[model samples]
Target chain A: MAEVRLVDVEKRYGGFLALPKQSLTIEEGEFLVLLGPSGCGKTTTMRMIAGLEEITSGDILIGGERVNDKPPKDRDIAMVFQNYGLYPHMTVQQNIAYPLKLRGVDRKAREARVRETAEKVELGALLHRRPSELSGGQRQRVALARAIVRTPKIFLMDEPLSNLDAKLRVSMRAELKHLHHELGVTTVYVTHDQMEAMTLASRVAVMREGRIVQLDTPKKIYSEPADLFVAGFIGSPSMNLVEGHITGGRFEAPGVSIPVAAAERGDVVLGIRPEDLELTTAEAPPIRGKLYALELTGEATLVTLREGATSICARGPAEFEAEIDAACALAPRPGARIHLFDKTTGQRIAA
Target chain B: MRDRSLQYVLLVPAFVIVLATTFYPLAYSLTTAFRDWDLTRSRRPEGWVGFDNFAHAFTESHFLNSLWVTTIFVVTSVALTLVIAMSLALLLRRKGRMHTFTRVVLILPFAMSPALIGVSYRFMFNPEFGVLSNGLAAIFPWLEGTAWLADPELAMAILVLTDVWHWAPYMTFMCLGGLASIPRETEEAARIDGASNIRIFFGIILPQMKGVLLVTAILKTIFALKMFDQVVTLTGGGPGTSTETLAYFIFNVGFEWYDMGYASALAWILTAIMMTISIWYVRMLLSERKMATA
Candidate 1:
């Protein structure tokens, strides 16, 4: 419903800078998630957008209007906190009707809208129940209902599903994505979970140490991380990183060497995702290693192999068997997916 | 069988102590309240006056008057304490260096001994040299000849005000503990829901503090009901017994008048009143819990 733009936004607590001059633009009706680990200023960014935290420098523009001086209420934005923050004292109906009441909606109209919104979130039965009496998932639905009832221009959610259990978190994630699709409101979600960001966000902004390292589509950010940090951060089981030097167009370490993609011919750290390492039975393998351990995780068996003294994780089919200390062959497939980064600068080397 | 025997064996000493210290006195008091026994009389009771003592004490206008006074003081002071304390707790909850200083200064009065507070207020309301009267008269010439503790209205007012001053801070401290325990996200959620500050306080913070407020209210009620020390020190129930509380009235009857029989009956009446109030308070609290959780 509205495009949110941050122009050189910054936050500071005394001498400690929480956020250092960050800029971003979230398109209208786009689900853009700011993703990072803890203390990475993702929540601060969300709060600033919601008008909960004051900006130390620069302005926030919502729908092409400067909102730096506006209070949260005047900005017409709704936020769902990380804890789901349902008012425990009020029934679900009251919680969802609060914003409408603040806006001076008449009683009959407010009740009708609340009923409709409650039904949308599948909370029609729970409208009379206090938050304490509801389960985790129900409370999350109430939070969503509260946000939707207002029909605000932008929705700011700060890891709202983090408090739910793993199974509930997954289901709630799907529900939230569906809700965003149905409502089509510009949403800025903050989460430390990369998988949530990857699945729910149209565009994901990866942050580290108060600065955004990469901002792009989920697939682009995951397949092509901006640097050593993003490469290590985005994937589960993490990408395999090895300290190797590029010499004579061949990347080499102790007991492991693979041909680089032509341009990265110098000392560079080699990065490959766990899924990118292909295991083959060819006699003259491009690289050879010995399996150190194997973990059977339902769908696939994760193999940890050691090339000389370095350890790398690789995902193989469930039927694949590689015992500890078994001989194995390794190769980085021919593509630009194999990332090379400068060892000193941590910057990705252009292929 | 062995477990039951072991439990009974462990309970024998505690049971004996309870019988000796608690039920024995209660039985003795019941028995003695029916008699006209005193120190002057022999150890053995001579006669049973059966309800005559109860009749005598109930008929005494002084005892009835003091009972009414105690009720007024208790209800007013306790209600005032809760209102003022909850307000102060909410005001000081957010973090700051100034908040810390204010908290320490506020809690200082509650930390002082009750007897000392009584003595200090006595000097403060003294007619000639008291800073309170001097300052009041200096600012308002209409109070030039006013001596607070001598006036019946002023004396009763001073007692109630001092009681609030000495105890409201303790309630504030407890309410602050309750406030701090409420999750910050819940409050933030309410704010984002567009509830105004007053609405949020009444609807969210106040209800969440119900348990702590109930307990503190009971305590303040008890303290005010036994309002003796300050009353005795400040005016000694003077100005023709205008400020005579139930506790002071009993003391006056037993120690000053030396009417042991009448005093014993009055003591029993006071005990009955206190027991009834405590039972009612506890019942209301239980019902409140059921209402909230149900």
Candidate 2:
């Protein structure tokens, strides 16, 4: 396994800066995921680490050696492309055995290792079939098998599970986590799926535009978002952000009032998670609004309330029932963390 | 019933066109291949010749020589054109102003008529005042004053060169179409798998191009076997029947010698060769489709 370090790296396409200068160090044997929406430069960063894309400036060091000028073949890294990239004309056996053959491994050893890798990926029965004959999930397994077959110093996966169906993606995600645990190889995964990042990564780097906005463990990022973007982007239903101001030690807006720790401010945004709010019938609850919508999601119901210009969503019990446009009140559950942010700058206010 | 009759009426024009254009000549030739019909001796077919006209082909010295010449021309031209076309495709597939301009320019040779290409090459290879002849002599002094179309080997080589020049660009466009269908991710994956650029080409790209190359070779083979225009315009069966390809020989037998029966038999033989290759090509394509869908 190797540590991948990007030191003051920047990428520019002509006059447009694709990735601003940034430094990141992915620890050895760590599963670091670059998570963001499309056009966020997450894939660009992974490609640069794989030696597939040229870094416009600064240096990339793998295992403590500068790899700025090294070709991909000389970098001792194996990658699983988003499209699987399996050879369409080659049988599964040949596809998995290619890296071994290229490294000049003897024929007998190559066959043995290929079989072992195939069995690990549960592909032993389909070794003779070409990629065109396999389903998409099978093709993904073949791509994964090929990367792990050679045991390269680092593995780069560029959203390898994105093409599979939702059910298969979850199972494959588990398999990937198990494989990383078994192999202990440094892996850099890129995806726009927040759930995949939360489940698979040792640390998630949330990127926006061209910069790393937040890089932290999944739990820490979920509990304490760095700013308004992270607070909205990390959660499933997302944190409700109410634009209001702190006055008389209480955050207030039309049809809403909430006590806060922050001092009186003109423009403050309140951030609260859906799971942190509970249905309440208190005469003067912290949050009061009219029920707008309700969605049942098996285990829980997503309840949305709108008060004037402010809209908030909260997770209620699965059996919770209410009429639309009815008056509603929601109060924070005990020990629920309350977040505050500066409205103008979208920066987190010190609490 | 009215719609059925209308369907039949709609197909009548196509059937009549096929019968008049394709079947009539084919049936006429098949019957004439077994008969004795010399135009100078009789205006109509004289008698049944059985296999006599077909047998005459194996025994005639000129016919055998023409067969040998055709074999050489077809083999050399197809191989040379395929290699050059594939190389050009590889070079021109990438995007750039220079590559696009070269690709546009490459179509000029293929766009020219085969007869016109032969005429141009004949003029360029003229012994005394030809541009190519003098250019070669300037580069290599020993080649000065050489009679390019007079010598048997040089004449055949020039014939193959002109054919390759006419067809290679068209075949290069075919190869480019084939190259475009291949995904770029496979190559990038190969690169990360520790395969060098050369290894990736041989191991990944070339194998995927097998179907396209086979189609190009078979199509070129069919074209080469029927090569007649160049033979007439460039070499004209040459200094002494040295470059007398089979199609040219068949022309000589029917028009010059007025031996219709013999020429018909020879034409049938050429048709049989082309038919056999075409059937094999179709079968290969069908099997490839089956493998893909499997």
Candidate 3:
């Protein structure tokens, strides 16, 4: 395995900048997940490291040797594309063995390695079948097998689980975690799925508009987002962001008021996670609004409340029941953290 | 009318045209191929000659020579066209201003009339004051006065060249369509797998292009087997009968020699060859579909 480093990398197509100058270092055997929305330059960053795309200005070093000028083949890296990229004309075994074959491995050894890789991916029976005959999940395994067949210095996976069904993606994600544990190759994985990054990454690099917005361990980043964009992005049902203000050590908006230790600012956005908010029938909770909707999600009921133009969703107990348009009080659960940010700049404000 | 009847009614004009233009001539040719008819002798056909014209074809040296020439031309031209067309297609597949312009210009070669292409090549290869001939002679002093059309091999080579130039552009478009269907990720995966550009093309891209290449080869082969316009316009059966293809020989047999019966038999043979090739093409397509499902 090898450590990968990108120094002052910049990418531009004509005059359009795809990636601004940025630097990152992925230590040996680290599974660094690049997480962002589409067109956020997450895939572009990984491709530049893989040498599949040309960096407008940068130095990419794998194992301390600059690979910026090297072609993908010479970079000693393997990539699994989102579509799997399995060769339709070849059997699964042949597809996995292609890397070893190109390196001039003999038939006897190639077959042995192919067999071992096939079995590792639970694809022994399907080795003789072409990609056309395989299901989506099975095809994804073939792509994984192809990347892991040979011992490359690094592995690049571009949303490899994105093509599989929801259930299949969960199972394959576990498989990938297991594979990385066993092989420990320095891997750069690109995906927009927060759960994948949270579960699989040693560190998550959340990107936005060609820049790394936050880079930290998943748990730390999830609990302590650097900015408003990240706090709103990382959670499901999304974090409830209410545009309010802080005046006289109290945060206030329409039908809501919260005592927070912050300087008086007319334009401030309050951020609270759904799970962190508690729905109550008390007279004056920190958040008060008319019930907009109630949705039962198996274990819990998500109570959505609206005050004027702003909507807030609070995850309440599963047994909780309420009607739409009823006045509801939502208080931050005891000791639950409330995040504040400057509304205009979207930067986190100390609270 | 009901929709079903309306569909059939709409096809009436095309059906009548096919029957009058295609089936009638086909039936007349089949009957005449078995009869003795010399247009110089009489306007009407004579008594039945039952395989006599077919037998004469096998024994006739002119017919045998034309068959040999046609085989050489078809084999050379088809192989050359496929290679050049596929290469051009690959080159043009990349997106750039120049590449787009080149792809548009590619149609010019295929769009020109075959007869006109022949006439142009003939003039271009003329030993006296021809641009290409004089240019080559100027570059190489040893080729000061070489006669390009007079030599049997050179004349046949020129015929194949003109045919390849005329057809490669059409086949190149076919190859481009095939190339587009292949996912870009597959080639990218190959590159990451340590395969060079050459290996990716031959190992990945070429294997996927099999169906398109087969179709192109069959079409070009059929076109080559019946080549006549270029031979007539360029060499006029030249210095000898060296450039005369099978279709050209059939024209000579029926028109110049007034041997209509034999010409009809030869035309039937060519049609049989084409029919057999078309059947093979269909079989290949079926197998390709089967492979896809499998």
Candidate 4:
């Protein structure tokens, strides 16, 4: 396994900067995921590392060697494309054995390794079938098998599980985690799915508009988001961001009032996770609004409340029931972390 | 029942046109192939010939020469056209101002009529005053004053060249269409799998292009077998029947020699060859599809 380093890397498409200058070091054998929405340059970064895209400026070093001049074939890296990229004319056995064949491995040994890799991916039965005969999930397994078959120094996966159905994606995600654990190969995965990043990555790099906005472990990034964007992006039923001001040591808006450690400031935004808030019946709760929408989500109910211009969502018990436009109160659960950010800059306000 | 009857009524006009244009001629020819009908000797068929007309083809020296000539022409022209079209497709697949301009210019040759192409090449390869002849003589002194369309081999070579020029661009467009359908990810994946550029093309791109190439070869073969206009306009069945292709020979037998029964039999033979190739192509394509889905 090899560690990959991008030093002051910048990508420009005819003066339109696609990726701003940035440096990142992916530790050896670590599953680092670059996560962002579309047009965020996450794929661009991975392609550059795979030697598929030319770097406008900067050096990419893999395993401590500058490989900017090396072709992809010489870079000792295997990539699983988002579309699977299986050879339609070849059988699954040939597709998985291609890298070994390219390396001039003998026929007998190549067949053995291909079988072993196919069995690992549970594809032994379908080795004779072409990609057109396989299901979407099976095709994904073939792409994965091809990459791991050769045991390249690093593996680059560009949203490999995105094409599968939701249920298959979850199972495939678990398989990928297990594969990484078993192989211990340095992998750089690029995806727009936050849940995949949280589940599969050793560290997640949240990117926005060509820059790495936050690069941290999944738990740390979840608990302490770097700014307003991370706070809103990292959570399901996303964190409620109230645009208000801190006054008299309390953050206050039209329908919300909460104590904060920050000093008095006018343009402050309050960030709180939906899971951190509990439905309360107290006379004077920290958050008071009229119930707007209630959605049952199997294990919990999503309760949204609106007061004037401020809207908030909180996770309540599955049996929680309330009428629309009725008065609703919500208070922070004990030991729930409260986040504050500067409204003008979208920067976190340390307390 | 009324709608079904109306559908049949609607198809009647098309059926009549097809019968008048296609089926009638085909049936008339099939019968004519087995009869003795010399236009100069009789207005109607003179007598039944059985397999005599078809049998006469094997014994005729000129017919055998034309058959040999056609085989050479078809094989060489189809191979040359396929290679040139595939290379042009690869070169023009990428986007650029120059490539776009070249692609637009490439259509000119294909757009020209085959007869026109024949006429132009005949003029260009004229021994004394032709521009191509003069240009080649200037580049290579030994080529000066060479009778390009007089020699048997050179005449056949020029014939093949003209056909390739006329068809290669159209076939290149077909190849480009085939290339466009292949996903770019497969090539990138191959590169990452440590396959060289050449290996990726031969292993990945060329294999995927099998269906398209086969279709192109079959089409070129059919067109080559039926090649008549160029033979007439370029060399007029050559300087002593040296480049007399089968279609030109059939024309000679019917119109020049007034041997209608023999000409019909020879035309049927050419049709049989084309039909055989087409059937083979269809079978290959079906098997390829089966393998892909298996």
Candidate with the greatest lDDT versus the true structure: 4
DockQ of each: 0.55, 0.69, 0.80, 0.75
Per-chain TM-score, chain A, candidate 3: 0.98
Q: List the residue pairs that clash in candidate 1.
A: none
Roughly what TM-score does model 4 have, to 2 decimal places?
0.98
- Candidate 2 reference-contact recovery: 0.78
- In model 4 chain B, the worst 10-residue window by lDDT is B285-294
- lDDT, residue A96, model 1: 93
Q: Which numbered prediction scores highest in DockQ against the true structure?
A: 3
**Residue A68 in model 4: lDDT:** 96
Write model 1 residue lDDT over B1-294, tens digit each, in one string. 999999999999999999999899777767777887664555554478999889987788998889988988888899999999999988888888798789889988888776677788878767688888888888988987787888887888888888999998988999999899787777776677677788878887888788789889888887888888887777788688889999999888767876566677777888888888888889988976775666
Model 2 C-alpha lDDT per residue in residues B1-294, reported as the tens digit of each score: 999999999999999999999999999989999999999999887799899999999998988999999999999999999889989899888887697689889999988988988898999999998899999999999999999999999999999999999999999999999899888899999988888878888889888887888889889999999999999999998969888999999999999999999999999999998899889987887687666567
The chain B TM-scores of all candidates, as shown, are 0.87, 0.95, 0.94, 0.96
**Which of the two, 1 or 4, has more TM-score?**
4
Candidates 1 and 3 compared by DockQ, better number: 3
Deviation from native of the Cα of residue A54 in model 1, angstroms: 1.9
Better of 1 and 4 by lDDT: 4
Local distance difference test, candidate 3: 0.91
lDDT of 3 by residue, B148-249 (tens): 999999999888999998999999999999999999999999998888888999999998898888888888888888898988899998768898889999
Score residue A335 of candidate 1 by CA lDDT.
62
Off by over 4 Å in 2: B1-4
lDDT of 2 by residue, A86-181 (tens): 988789999999999999999999999999999999999999999999999999999999999999999999999999999999999999999999
lDDT of 2 at B216: 90
lDDT by residue (tens digit), candidate 3, A220-270: 888888898899889898888889888888989997788888898889999
